[model samples]
Target: MMLPARGGPEPCGGNHGSGRDHSPARAMREPTAMTASPQPPSPQPPPSANPAATPARAAPPIRIAIIGTGTIAHTQHVPVIRAHAGFELVAGVNPTPVPWWAEATGGLKLFSSMDSLIRSGMSVDAVAICTPPATHYALAAQGLAAGWHVMLEKPPTPILSQAMDLHRLACAAGRTLMTSWHAACAPAIDPARQILASGGVRGMRVTWRENVRKWHPGADWFWKPGGHGVFDAGINALSIACAVMGEPLFVTGATLDIPAGAATPCTAQVRWATPSLPDGMEGIFDWTHRGIEVWDIAWTLGNGRRLLLSQGGGGLSLDGVAVTLRGTHEYECVYSRFERLVHDGASDIDYRPVALVEDILSAGQRRPADPSFRILP
Candidate 1:
C-alpha cells in the first residue's frame, strides 16, 4: 500500500521559526472581537493549498478554544494552554455541562455544544479537540469551517477516510490541522532519530504492556468499536518509532487477542515490514499486564550498537550509556508546534501512525481472550 504524505508536526528538535510578532492590538483583542461570527461564507471552490497566497497574520497569544473539556483537555491541554505564553485559553465546548471543578476554577466560558458556542459569536484562532476518536471528524470539520486551526487527539479519527477528508478540508480552508500525537513530542525522540540516521536498523522490537483497568479506570469507551483498545497505547510506541526512524512503517502481519464480549482487542502482536529490516520490528501490546508497566522500544543498528527508548520514549539509552536529553514536556512541545503552525498558516496531519493502527485492526488475525473487562455506562 502507498503511504500517505508525511508532513505533520516536525520533530521537537527542529527550529519552528522565530515567533516575533509583538502586536499589542492582536494580543489585547478579546475572543468575541476576533471574528464577528463562527460561520464561513458561501463555499467557493476549494482554494489552492498554498498558505503563502494569503499570508496568515495570527499574532502571538493565539485565542484558542478547547472542544471536549474531557480528561485530556483538563489534565494535558488546559494546563498547557494556560502555561504557554503563546496561547490564550478562551473557552470550551462540551455537550455535557461543565463539571463543578471547571465551573468553579477554570474561569472558562463553557457552551453545551458547538452550535451554542457559535450562536454566542465567540471567536478563536484555533481549537484543540480532546473528544473520543469517533467524534473527531465532525468536530474538526466544524472547527475548520469556522475558520479555526484544529488539533485532534491521537488517532485523529477511527476511520482513515474521515481523517483524509479532514485533511482536504483543512488544506482548502488554508488552516492548520494538527494530529496530537504527543508521544512523538518526547524529548529523546529527535536525538534517537539523529542516532538512527547514522546507521541502518538491523532489528527493532516494541514491548508495551499496561493494566488497562489501572490506567483507564472507568473509561468504558475503551472497549467499544471505535475505541482502539490495546492499540490506543500501542500507537504511541509506533509514533515514536516512526519519528525515530524518520520514515513510515507498515504492518505485515498481526495477531489480536480480543476479549470475549469486547469489540476491540486486549492484546496485539504486530509485525512491521520495512526496507532495512524485512523480517524485523515486532510490537507487542497488552492491556492485561499486572505489574510494572512496560513501554519500551529497542533497536539493533547495522553497526555494533544498541538503542533503547524506555518509559514511553521519555528516556533514551545507547550502548549501556544513558544519553541525557533536554526539552519541554511533551504536551508543551505539542502546543509550541501548534503555535508555529498557526503562525505559519500550515497543517501538519501525519497519517502513518493512524494508518498503521487501522491496518493492523482491520487485517489482523483474531482469537478470543478471557473477558476481564466490564464496559461501563
Candidate 2:
C-alpha cells in the first residue's frame, strides 16, 4: 500500500513566481522495494559491461537537439552524446552563444531558441531538456507536440500535475518521454535494488548534503521560488529512495530552513513512510551541510542484513565489505536507455519523485531560516 498525500491537492508554499501552477495532485503509488541503508559485503556486477555487447541496433543514430547548455549539459550530457554511437549531436539551443568547450568540440549547429532550431529545419529526432525546472513543462510540451522524443532533467516539472500532463501529452503525440534521475542510474543502484527485492526491509537512512557555493556557485535561480532550494539536490536522493522503497505513503513530517533573502529552503529534514515496510520502517531525507560533501543511503533489513550505497551510488558495500562495481557513467547509461526506448517506441516517465516532492510540499511544515546560513550573491 502507498501512503496518501497528507494535505489534499495544494501547491507547496514557496516563491514560485514563474506563473505556473505549482499545485500538486494526488499521490501516485509505484512498485515496492525495501529502503536503502548500510550493509555487509555482497555480490557485485562486473567492473563494466562491454559496449560491443550492448544489443545491436540497425536503426540510424538518433539526431538530438540539446536544450540548455549549462553546467550539467556541458559536463555530462554533451560529452556522453559525443561518445555514444546511438546518438548524433545535431543542434544546440541556448540564448547565449555556444560555450567555448561546446564550440571547440566541432560539429554542432547552434540556435537561439527551440523555435529557431525547429524553424531552421534541423532534423532532430529527440531533444534533451536541460533547462531550469520552471521551464521544463513548456519546453517538453513543445518538444512532444513537435513529435520529438524528450528526456527531461529530474523533478520533471515544478508540480505533479504538470508532470502528469506531460505524460499524457507524450502519449497523445506518440513520443517517448523520459525523466532522467541520474543518481538512480548509478552503477551501485542495481545491486542495491537486487538485495532489497530478495529480503524484508527494516528502515532507511539517507544523508545527502553538499555545498551550494561549491556546486552551484552564483546560480541565483537556485534560491528562487520554484528553484526548489535544497530540494534541487534533495530530490536526487528522494528519487533513489523511492526507487528502492517504492512509492512513499506520504511525507510524515518535514522542516525547511530557508535563508534570509532566499525564496527557497537552504536546508531540509523530511521523514517519509511506505506501506511495504513495517510501521517502524522509517526513512529520513536530509540536505543541509557545508565544507565536505556526503551522499549516502543505508538500509537495514529485517534479518539484520545491511546494505549501503555511498558516493552518490558510485560505491557499494554489503556486510561491511566494499563491493567493487562498474565505473560510474550514469549519463551514458541514460543515453543508452533512451536509445532503446526511442527505437522501441516506449515511454518511461516515473512520477513517483514528483509525487514525493508534492507530498512534502503539501504536508511538510516550514521553519524559520537558519540565522547563520547566508545566501551568497
Candidate 3:
C-alpha cells in the first residue's frame, strides 16, 4: 500500500539573478554527496600593477538559446539558464510571439522557427529543447545536426527508438546530448544511491500522487497521445528509482486507469520484478490526489531499518529522522553537469526511465476511469 502524504514539493535552492554575469564565481553552486556541504566561492585576488602579473582570463560563457518558450521555459529553463554563469542566453525560437520574452532574455533575437534561427547565422553553442515530447526528437536532431550541444527535457522522446536515434546522431556529431532527468539531480538521490549500493535493499515502494490542476492547470497536451499523461510526473519516480538502484527496472505487469475520452491513463499501478525481494517493487502513480502532492519512495532494508526519499528526492530520512542535505538545486546541478559534458566532449544519455514507462504502457491492462483533467481547447 502507498504511504500517507509527507509534504508538498519543495522549491529548489540556487543563485537567483538575471544571468548577465560572466564571471565563474557566479556559476552554479556545486554540492557534494551526502553530508558534503557546498563550499563558498573563492575570493578574487587583487589586480597586479604589472601587465604580466595578471592571470589568464577564464573561458567565455557558452552562448545558448532556448526553444519553445512555454510554461516550462518561462518558469524553469529560462531562469536557470539566465542564472548560470557558464551560459549566456542569446536567442529563442517560438512560432508565437512572446512580448515579455524580449525583456526576459535581455532583448535576445527571437526567431519564429528553428529554421529562421539557423538561417540567421547566429553563434550558439547549445540549445535546450523544452518542447512537447512528440517534438523532442525532431528539435534535438536539428540541434545536434547544427553542431550544437543539446539538452532535452524529461522523456526525451515518446518511444525508445527515437531516443536511441538521437543518441546515435549526437555521438556521430561529437556533440553533447543530455537527457535532462531533473529529479535524478535532486540532493537526496546520490545519498540514497550510496546507501542502496552498499546492499541490503529488501523491499521498495513508490507512491507518486499530485493534483494535476494545481501543477499543470489547463495544459491539455498532457492528455493527448504522446503526452504521457500521468507518466509525465510518474517518470520522475522511475528515474529516481533507477538512479538510486543502480540497475535497470523490469516491469512484470501493470494496471492503468485511463480516463474517458483521454488518450492516456490518469493513474497507474505497476509491479516490478526484483530478484532480491519476494514482493518486488510496486509503484502507484495517480494524478487526481488532492491537497499536498506526494512524490515519495520507501525502502525496507534487511536490517529492519527504513529508508525514505520524499519530496521527489529532495529530502532523505532514515528511521523517521531527517538528514541535512545540500545540492537541492536540481536545475543548477543539471546545468552544471551539462557544462561538464560539453567541456569534456561527452554525453549523458540514460533511457532506462523512458524504457520502463514504455514497458508498463505496452504490457499494462487498461480500464476506463472518471475524468478529472481539464483539457484546454
Q: What lDDT would candidate 3 get against the real structure?
A: 0.74
CA shift at 184, candidate 3, in angstroms?
0.5
Candidate 2 lDDT, 43-157, residue by residue in tens: 1211232465455769899999889887777767777787777898888888987645456348577788999987887688999999888889999999998889999987688
Query: Candidate 1, which ten residues in sequence have the lowest lDDT sum?
Result: 33-42
Where model 1 places Cα greater than 4 Å from the true spot, the runs are: 1-60, 100-106, 371-377
Off by over 4 Å in 2: 1-50, 101-104, 246-249, 276-288
* Alpha carbon lDDT of each predicted model: 0.71, 0.69, 0.74
- Against the true structure, whose lDDT is highest? 3
Ranking by lDDT: 3, 1, 2
Root-mean-square deviation per candidate: 11.3, 8.6, 11.5
TM-score of 3: 0.83
Tens digits of per-residue lDDT for model 3 on 1-377? 23235744433211111011221112323543322211110112111122232223376888899989877777667777776667889999999999779777788898999999999999999999988888899999999889999999887888888987887788788898887877777777767876776757877889999877767767767787766778988998987786677445678889988787787888999898765554667999988878777888998876778899988876789999996676435665677778877887877777777888888989999988665443442
